[model samples]
Target: MKKTILVTGASSGIGRATAKLFQSKGWNVIATMRTPEKETEFTELANVLVTKLDVLDLDTIDSALAQGIDKFGKIDVVLNNAGYGLMGTFESAKRESIIRQFGVNVQGLFDVTQKTLPHFRQNKEGMFINISSVGGRMTFPLMPLYHSTKWAVEGFSESLRWEMAQIGVKVKVIEPGGVATDFGGRSLDLQHNQEFAEYNEFVNAFMKAMAQSMNPETMTKPEQIAEVIFEAATDNSDKLRYRAGADCEQLLGARDKMSDEEFFAMQKQILGL
Candidate 1:
């Protein structure tokens, strides 16, 4: 009678860590990724069900959920951890990048949650953990679209929580500051805008500074997020959000404690922008 959890983007980093941690805790884990075969880490784990799932693909998402339900009888939690980051100035950002960002970050998460609602309603119990970011609360230069999506998740998850309250379904959002993950590495979409070559040097320096500033240790570990997620899923509390990193704590604190001008000025000073 172990509680079952389905985690998307389970091939690497946060998603991978969350899935593994849940498995270690004896929860039945349906760990899914764009291509599960490409990831050998979860393939051999005990109590982990590796499946292929690309959040952008509707058919694949549905198939994975159906298969998970068949195997586990019920899904106690759904973790929407599948997403990537797009970095560039607003003027330099491409339409396609914006679409892709919203597609996976917002649309994909929405689709997955919608797909699982019937099951949760039927069972009268389930938790949906949506992965947002500290950027949602505070934004930096050249990350407009990325910030927009996470901000959307913040609003969306909160609204969904109220809507689901009567049915015993919980929607929780985890806002982590940059963690030690490839999300800011290989997953970062760093396209140059020759059209804005005027700002090329400035933009390049900014991007490099970002990579340098995001020291993993200064941020949170993926396990920190996993631990927080575990609490959200099992604690049965009324809390609707959890901030999972030191950077998040600082940023949220600043948001609460500082004026708009003070906050923006402090951020610019820290980022050297």
Candidate 2:
């Protein structure tokens, strides 16, 4: 029987690319997003179900899972790709943005995993592929909130692997570095307060450095990351982490080779601090 994969945040970017890639590979895809009605791309695709699933909304999570299982009979894999970055200084961040960043990136992921565990447990086998970032393992200036949540995801996924393994459920994390996605555009929430003008110069320098480093021409493509996800899904290995980009490999490799102080110094030098 053909396997089924459910992907959250399927309206765009990595989520959309992964959903389409799986579908093209003959897997049934439950492509979920907050507003399914506005999605026009996956409507006509065979074995692809575009449905509503807001990670923060438990009702939607349950409904989407039910809808997928009802149609495809079983869901063999779930890609938790619904998250965004909260950029800017933490001091300038509103309480709402802080809460929301954790809500969607960390709590929402927990909710989805908790809800899906039963199904996977019952099946005696399943896989969960979470979309983290190079930010998860390292950090840069002005994105503490985004980095914190991703770090949480990394720790959670790593720890969950042991427990999930007992139930025959596999847990994997994909750490992509600067993918060419709207993550820096529509998917990013910039927090700034006029009162915190002292941070203005620092933020400006950081942004300029980021712009140079995150050139679209150099960044990994979402489709490329999707291929990595697919490999993790089908590789049938006990590997817990898959680095998806050359940048990821380089940055994470450097991180592994350096001490904490060295890494911090390198990051500071990169931002011209």
Candidate 3:
């Protein structure tokens, strides 16, 4: 029998691309999004079930899982790709924004993994391909909220791998450096504070440097990330991390090899901050 994969946040970007790629490979795809009604293309595809799954809602998660299993018999992998970044200085972040960040990126991911663990344990073989970023292993200024969530993801995946190992379940993390996705437009939240005008120059410098650095010439595409996800699913390795974008390993390597001050100096020099 062909394998099956369930992908979250499949309305666009990496998740959508992954769903398409897996289906083309003859795998049953459970392509889920918060608003499945907003999607049009996946509905017409055979062996693909476009379902509604809001990560924050456990009920939706359960429903989607049940629906997928009922339709496809069994799911071999679960790709946690539904998340958004909250950007800006921590002090500028609203109470609700801060809560929402952890709620979705951290707690939301935790809930999904927790719900899937029992199923995977029962199967004695499964995989979790988490869509984290290179930012998960590194950090930048004016992005405490965003970085915090990614850092949590990295740590969570690392620790969880040990537990999953006992049951033949595998955990893999995709760390992309700079991807030209809707993340910068729709998946980003900008936190600001008029009271903190003193920090405006810093934020402006950071944004300017970021925009100049993560251009199309250097960034990865959705298809590229999809390819990496496919490899992780079929690589058949006990490996835990898969670096996806051009700068993913390079940027993360600096953090691993250099001291905090040295890494910060290099990053500042590159950004001209």
Candidate 4:
């Protein structure tokens, strides 16, 4: 029987690319997003089901999964790719933004995984490919909220694997470095307070450094990350993590070999702080 994969946040970027790639490879795809009505491209695909699934909405999550199982028989893999970055200073972040960062990235992922567990447990085989970030393992200047949630995801997935193994449910994390996506655009919630005059100089320097770093020509493509996700899904290994870009490999490598003070010093030097 042909396999099926369910992807969240499939309206754009990595999720969309992964959904399309899996469909092209003869896998049934449940391409889910907050507003399925706005999607036009995936509607034309043969084995793809574009549906509504806002990670923050439990009802939508349940409905989308049901819709996928109804249309494609069984879901063999689930790619939890629904998340965004909350940038800028954490002190300037609104209470709602802080709550929302954890809600969508951490709580939402937990809900989806918990909801899907029964099905996978009964089937005796399934896989979860979570979209983490290089920030999950390391840190940057202005994205404390975003990095915190990803770090939570990393720890949760790593620990969950042991229990999941008993039921043949595999858990894997994909850590991608800076990608050429709208994450720095519409997907990013930047919080800043001009009233915090003390942070102005540092914030300005950090933003300037970030702008220079986010070169699309040098960053990894969403399609390339999708390819990595596909490999993790089919590799059938006990590997718990997969880094999805050359930058990811480099940064993670440095973190692995360096001490905490050394890594922080390097980061400060790079950001010119």
Candidate 5:
């Protein structure tokens, strides 16, 4: 029988691409989103099972797992890809924004993983793939909220891997850098910033700089990330992290080769300040 894969936030971007790729590969793909109605197209696919799963809802997470097992009999991988980005400086971000960030990105992920652990432990084999970001490893001035959540995921995954090792469970992190997805437009929500307003001209200049630096051709495609995720899900190696995009390569390389100060300087240069 083919292996089974459960993907959260499967309505779009990397999650949708990953689900389709797995279904194409003959895996039983449980493609779940906050609203199954939104994923009418995925339900039409033969190997894909569309289920309702709002990561923020504990009951929905449980229902999704139950449905996955009922449909596929086994879940070999759980891809935690449901998250949003809060784009703005820390001082400008409201308390509610911070709460929402931790609630969805950190708490929701924790709840889902906790709910899945029992099944994986009983089966004695499974994989957990957390979709993190390059910003998790390095940080920028304006994106502190987004960076904090991802950084938390990175730390959480690393620590969880050690505990899961004895049970034949595997944990893998997919860290992608600046992909030209609707993520920038849809995922990010900006907030008030009085101090940064004086820097608005600088901000616009930086935005232009960012646009110029991002290479469309080299930008990590959703399919490319899906491929990496598929490999990570299937492989049983000791490797815990897979950097899956051009920006990831640059960031990881700088982390590996340069001193902290040097890397910071390089980031400053890139911002053209």
Candidate 6:
């Protein structure tokens, strides 16, 4: 039987890239997004099933899972790639924005994972390839909220991996650093306020440094991430964590080697604070 994969937030970037790559590899692709109608490219493909799946909406989440199974008969892996980064200063962020950050990044991811549990439990064999960030293992200025969500994902997926071992289900996390995706552009939510002009110098410096991190020469590509996701999906190894690109390994290496105070001091020095 051919393997099948379900990908959320497949409109563009890592999700879109993964769907295309998996389809090329002959895996059935469930390319889901918030607006299925807006997707014009994937519909023409024979094996691609473009559907609506907003993470915040439980109805759509369950419906998409059912729809994928109805078409493919079985789902081997679920790529929970439907999240955006909530960037900028947390202090200046509106309460609503802060809540929505957790809403999409943390709560939405949790909801999707929970919804997939029943189907995975029934199948007796399945995998959840969650897309986390290297930020989960480290920190960055002006991205406290974003880092918090990723840290939550890292913890959640790690614990889930342990618990799922009892069953046949497998959980793996992909930690990518500064991938050159729309994640740094349209998908990023920034907080700003004229009322808090004092932090502008630090904020601007941080944004500049963050932008440099996403330069094509320094960052990982979405297609490269697709390869890691594929390996996590098919490698069948019991390994629970996979680092994508050299930047992820290096930065996370620093975090792993440094003490708490040392890491903070190193980060402050790098940011020129």
* Local accuracy of candidate 2 as per-residue lDDT tens digits, 1-273: 999999999999999999999999999999999999998889999999999999989999999999999999999999999999999888889898899999999999999999999999999999999999999999988889999999999999999999999999999999999899998898999887867889888888888898888888889999999999999999989999999999999999999999999999988987787
lDDT of candidate model 3 versus the reference: 0.89
**Deviation from native of the Cα of residue 1 in model 3, angstroms:** 0.7
Candidate 6 lDDT, 1-273, residue by residue in tens: 998999999999899999999999999999999999999999999788999999989999999999999999999899998888887777788888889889888898899889988888888889999888898888788788989999999999988887798779999999998888887678998877757899888888878876665687657889999999999998979898899988889888988898999989988887667
Please, what are the lDDT tens digits per residue for candidate 3 over residues 151-217?
8899999999998999999999998878888888899998878679998988888898888776775
* lDDT computed for candidate 2: 0.94
**Candidate 3 C-alpha error for residue 129, in Å:** 1.0
TM-scores of all candidate predictions against the true structure:
0.96, 0.98, 0.97, 0.99, 0.94, 0.96
lDDT of each: 0.88, 0.94, 0.89, 0.94, 0.87, 0.89
Model number with the top TM-score? 4
| lDDT (Cα, tens digit) per residue for candidate 4, span 173-237 | 99999999999998999899989999999999999999999999999999999999999999879
**All-Cα superposition RMSD per candidate:** 1.3, 0.9, 1.2, 0.7, 1.6, 1.3
Worst 10 residues of 5 by lDDT: 190-199
lDDT of 1 at 98: 85
Clashing pairs in 1: none
Model 5 lDDT per residue over 1-273, tens place: 899999998988899999999999989999999879866788788978898998878899999999899988999999999888887656678998899988888888899899999999999989999999888888876778888899999999999999999898999999988776767677777774756677677667766776677666767888899999988987768788899887789788988899989988998887886
**Which portions of model 2 miss their true places by more than 4 Å?**
none
Clash counts for all predictions: 0, 0, 0, 0, 0, 0
Deviating ranges (above 4 Å) for candidate 3: none
Error of 4 at 85 (Å): 0.6
Least accurate 10 contiguous residues by lDDT in model 2 = 190-199
Which stretches of candidate 6 lie above 4 Å from their native place? Answer: none
Error of 1 at 183 (Å): 1.4
